[model samples]
Target: MKKYRITVNGKTYEVEVEEITAPAPAPKKETPSVSTIEAPKAKAEPAPTPAATPKKATPAGKLTINAPMPGTILSIKAKPGSAVKKGQVIMILEAMKMENEILAPQDGKILSIEVTEGSSVNTGDILAVME
Candidate 1:
């Protein structure tokens, strides 16, 4: 047994550990002849069909804001058809336990919000569109 002191989260504690030894290997049994064994036939499975995904129609020459990293949408600050200025915060995203502000790319009216609060998003997922 070994004694040691450990500190975690600003707390200290003393503990002891016992050393364990590996067990001896067991004796091997004789193998059966291959000629006496029978293999089962395998059945082929059909391929799965892909699910249909709804597409969002983006207007021409509009700016689309995408998520910077994988995260959950914490809250939305701007609404559709609302006017926003360049560098304005439009939404908040929670990623890695941190709250990140989603900002507007340029001055424009928000055409649509692609994601809602509490929605999980991946990197490059569309968040909103403006024009």
Candidate 2:
């Protein structure tokens, strides 16, 4: 056996380590006859619980345009008072180091611009409005 003392942060402690020997191996038991044992029957699994129905997301209004995901506004392609068609690119959002185009969802004149260039927005945040 060996003993040692250690000090840490003004506290001292003594530790002793004894030499270890390998343990003797255990003896193996004889296997039982397979015919003497009956096979176990499978248990039936419980039925899965039903999930809750999700509520529909109702937009505040048809004219409100919201961000689809969290990101920074890279550029605004159209400004207020500008006429736009459905599927037209309205702005660029930088998210996850990639540029994503924000599109005009319907044909209308932009009523207001809610976010400025280089501004950060989260999912469902209003970015623009049209009517």
Candidate 3:
């Protein structure tokens, strides 16, 4: 048996508890927890204003390629400083039980690769950048 004193939110409480912790009763095996909180439903916060969208880069400028759909990145076929051709396969993305080849949007050098193999990505996740 033990006694405990707790303070939270500028309030104090004294509690007495018995410590006869044997194998927890079957179908009620969860450890008992002590709290001074009142459970309540969560309230959603207001959405924030969206920032302005950046202009998409052209072949002469750095172009970022985002995931066309949500999926795991199976492989990144190119790295930074690698030359790529228009419509060249730059990455392989796996989504919905399919392995889809990602093609370069334009002829350019790979400027950056944003995701690694086996990493999960969502639609619009920046996958690579070319310039």
Candidate 4:
């Protein structure tokens, strides 16, 4: 075993590590609370990952309403393919201990409701599309 001392912010600690020979492969373990996300497969093979450069996202619709800040979706007041009026409440986004109504910015059919109640969203995340 080898011992080493570490100091951080005026604190010190000792650690020991031992060398092992011919180590066996460790068993793979899965946690009960961990979920494995599988991506869509193409023709029985794994899809290739995208390039390092982020693809420019297609510009969202002109009349789409986006999240104002990071928050939880407290409620959804509209559905997909429904007609909505300008300034109508589409969802209640909760942030900073207050519920902010996410309203529509234009009169159009609700192309999609991107989030459901209890969803966590961030600033500039698309919440709904109108077209």
**TM-score, per-candidate, Cα-based:** 0.58, 0.54, 0.55, 0.54
Error of 4 at 128 (Å): 0.8
Clashing pairs in 1: none
The worst-scoring run of ten residues by lDDT in candidate 4 lies at 50-59
lDDT against the true structure, per candidate, is 0.92, 0.88, 0.87, 0.83
Off by over 4 Å in 1: 1-57
Comparing 3 with 4 on lDDT, the higher-scoring candidate is 3
Per-residue lDDT of 1-131 in model 3, one digit per residue for the tens?
Answer: 68899998989999899977589756866889988988898899998987654544544656889999999999889989999999999999999999999999999999888889999987787888888
Please report the TM-score between candidate 3 and the true structure: 0.55
> After superposing candidate 2, which stretches have Cα over 4 Å from the reference?
1-62
Task: Kindly list the per-residue Cα lDDT of model 2 for residues 1-131, writing each as its tens digit.
Answer: 99999998999999999988989789769876665677899899998986643423434654888899999999999989999999999999999999999999999999888899999988878888888
lDDT of 4 at 77: 93
lDDT of 4 by residue, 3-119 (tens): 999998999999999988987999869656878999887677688985553222435554667789999999999999889898899999999999999888888888777788999
Candidate 3 yields a Cα-based lDDT of 0.87
Runs with alpha carbons beyond 4 Å of true place in candidate 4: 1-62
Q: Which structure among the candidates has the greatest lDDT?
A: 1
Using TM-score as the measure, the top candidate is: 1
